[model samples]
Target: NGASRFGRLRQTLAGVSEKMLTQTLRTLERDGLVRRTVYPEVPPHVEYELTALGQTLREPLKALTEWSVVHIEEVITARGEYDDRAERTR
Candidate 1:
């Protein structure tokens, strides 16, 4: 999205550091899950987009993201319940 800048990606994913983000991008590129494009110029422009193989991940990842958004409250509630039970057992 937005020409595939790192800042935009970091914002979307949240909590990704510069180093870890670079590593993740390289890993995906190596695995043939994503393609990196570079434009040769001063202050070179770059873009990262999913390859066909990577596009295959869209469905599952999208589903997971949607599920988290929908069920985050339930997850937090479960965590609280577990912590309460643990405290009571101590």
Candidate 2:
């Protein structure tokens, strides 16, 4: 299903705190990148799904993730070199 429940999303995205996840979802919704639906049940149930605009970002985001993974070692090495230089200067 395109839509997903809050709990399901939390389970899928491990290590994210409930509060942070909620806040992130709210931010995305406010940005018009995500649509939120609240069901009128005994206990309210909420679902979130990507808006058309948000869906358009999927490929670019994926590419960025792949690029980060590929260049992670380079980034770490650069950071280490920078830190070493700063330490020598100090």
Candidate 3:
């Protein structure tokens, strides 16, 4: 999903600390992957979007998301089996 802003991107990519995410974004921007925009307002506002190279990631990212959603059951089942096998051997 295309976010309206950088804050939105941070929120969407869960479990990332704000500071680390900020630095990561800066690096990506430096690498010419993400575009950052600043809007003048009383407090100021910022937005982040993908550059052409970044946009190319959309399809694979979406596919990965779909795979996680569709194969969640298999993932869980495999995890349980692994844990059980480990416990028996222990």
Candidate 4:
């Protein structure tokens, strides 16, 4: 909903390694999809927030999530069919 510090993001995204998260954040920042802000303090503070361009993806991503939930069974069935055909050719 707003800016998120690294620790907060790491907590929210379970199983994501710090290195991977840092890389992903850097990539997003480079792509203009996210903004990174560093604050001067005793220990230094940093936060990441989505850019306007990134915010535009919220609806589309949500739609995709909904679609996947609805069609997951079909996707699994298609994968099984493809695997069966491949096994027949071997």
Candidate 5:
């Protein structure tokens, strides 16, 4: 939610490859949606946090998540019907 290390973010988002995560983080940072901080230390520590603009997405993202959860079955069913129609045409 707040500041988090790469390892913690990777762990929280299961099944994401390091390369993908790194790329995504870089893109977000580039887009000004996330802030990356590097601390000079023995091994160098880095942390990522949502920028003010990113924080503004919280409610909209949450609403999208809820909508997906509620409409997943319908979406799946529609996909199946579409696939069947496509196959028939083929």
Candidate 6:
């Protein structure tokens, strides 16, 4: 589907609260990166989708996400080494 509800997005992100998700979505929509559509129904149904500009950013973001996943261990190890060096200097 081109659009997704707040709950779906929250679940997809895992551990994101309703308020945080709402704020993030609102920010994205306000910045012209996301489109929010509200449907008139028995209960108001809202959906969010990436705008064209947002779509353009997907690939690079995905690549960055993948890189982080791959390098997380190395990053953690480097941090520990740096911390140890700093402690030794003190």
Model 4: per-residue lDDT, tens digit, 16-80? 99999999999999999999999999798999999999999999999999999999999999999
Q: For residues 1-79, what per-residue lDDT tens digits would candidate 2 score against the true structure?
A: 3999999999999999999999999999999999999999979988899999999999999999999999999999999
lDDT of 5 at 27: 100
- Work out the TM-score per prediction: 0.77, 0.84, 0.68, 0.81, 0.89, 0.84
lDDT per residue (tens digit) for residues 1-90 in model 5:
899999999999999999999999999999999999999997989999999999999999999999999999999999999999999999
Taking all chains together, the TM-score of candidate 2 against the true structure is 0.84
Shift of residue 55 alpha carbon in model 5, Å: 0.5
Decide which is better by TM-score, 2 or 3: 2
Q: Which stretches of candidate 3 lie over 4 Å from their true place?
A: 1-3, 39-42, 88-90
Q: Evaluate residue 48 in candidate 5 and report its C-alpha lDDT on the 0 to 100 scale.
A: 99
| Residue clash pairs of candidate 3 | none
Q: Report lDDT (CA) for all predictions.
A: 0.88, 0.96, 0.87, 0.98, 0.98, 0.92
Model 6, 1-90: lDDT tens digits are 388998889889998888888899999999999999999997899999999988988899999999999999999999999999999999
Candidate with best TM-score: 5
Local accuracy of candidate 3 as per-residue lDDT tens digits, 1-90? 454676677778899999999999899899988988888996789878789999998899899999999999999999999999999998
Candidate 1 lDDT (Cα, whole model)? 0.88
Q: Evaluate model 1: give its TM-score.
A: 0.77
Which is better, 4 or 6, measured by TM-score? 6
The candidate with the higher TM-score, 3 or 5, is 5
